[model samples]
Target: MTDETQIMEINKPISKTVVAIKRIDYVDIAKGIGIVLVVMGHNDFALISPFAHKLIYSFHMPMFFFMSGMFFKPDLPFLMYARHRFNRVLKPFLFMILFIYFASISFSNVGIPQASRRLIKALYGNGHYLDWVQLWFLPHLFVVSLFAYFFFQAVYRRGLFPLRWVILSVLFIGGVLGITLFWPFEPDILGRGFTVFGLPFSLDLVFVSGFFSSWGMS
Candidate 1:
């Protein structure tokens, strides 16, 4: 190889590192702020005024989804990207939720039958059903990130990035409508009157969170 080509090769990795550092710098700051807000929001019931608590809760979670989108790349194939996400997001979610659930069974007064029922509900991945409610964000984020990948891939592959905002807006609106229309349909399982809400894995919130993620991408 030419000396010039060697020099280019040496600089490429350095340049990439610098670019990545620059890209995530502000994102890191925003994420730090959001983290503090999330903690405060969770514990602020009597520590802060009602309006202050409301303000903190308003955007903390959406901010995370938005930041997650900022890291999206539409270049990877579907399975590869999905596997990567499974390892990074879903795996951690499963590990932590299981850890908490088992800890409750081992130490707390939770009985085996009750624990079994809770485990079943936890499969739904909805916060309301989990022992640790705050963990609901992980599975929800995992789904949103995957949805964003497909949505962006479709747009990018079709050379429709120019119209991405319009497409995203339509999809987001449809998602909202679907959620609204289905809000009342709590289907009973086995005619036992047990109902599931928001769908498994929080799939229903995809478009809602997608809007924030799209903003991050833009």
Candidate 2:
């Protein structure tokens, strides 16, 4: 009959329901498998087989993105999300880039002319060959994460059903088909120009699709 006792009784059912819902196990399994595969794929060891590499490349990173989307509920304010994202992504990207630049210079015997030219090209806009091989995923993943976060926020705000799997599938299919249709039959200036769009189409499509799919949207 007391106020405190009444409050406790009223909250008990809700708390128990939440506790029951929190015990889902599939998410943890998916995350564990994805992380293990990612680490194995990245490691420079003989343990990796071609089939394993292909499987990891196909699903591991995408699964990570999807898992991220599942938990993309921005509880903190927008400013907090922005600050966290900058610290987690942009700062590290800059530091790694600078580190790679200096490391290349320190280790390589390439003459000053060639190294300087390559450094200048990388700093300006022309992509570096080293970057093409090693750190390419960082920038691409950062962009995809930022996009997914903002997209999830918008979806939450609009009160839309997060079942966007069909929409994502359409985008993915359309993008692939469009790229295939415009595939260059011959090497030409314009043919090369079309290749630039390929990254956005393929990367973003996969990233967002994985996100939605992990959320049971697919």
Top candidate when judged by lDDT against the true structure: 1
- Stretches off by above 4 angstroms in model 1 are 1-23, 45-47, 182-184, 188-193
lDDT of 2: 0.57
lDDT of 1 by residue, 159-184 (tens): 99889889888988888888855443
**Which stretches of model 2 miss by more than 4 angstroms?**
1-32, 42-49, 76-79, 111-134, 178-218
Candidate 2 local lDDT, 1-218, one digit each (tens)? 99999998988855344444574599988877877776788776326477767767777666766666666545777778767766776576567666766777789776667766765544322123335343554555555556666656666456664545554666566755554442322435955632332342235344445454335421
Clashing pairs in 1: none
Q: What is the C-alpha RMSD of each candidate to the true structure, in Å?
A: 6.6, 9.6
Each model's lDDT comes to 0.80, 0.57
In candidate 1, what residue range of length 10 has the lowest lDDT sum? 13-22
Estimate candidate 1's alpha-carbon lDDT, on a 0 to 1 scale: 0.80
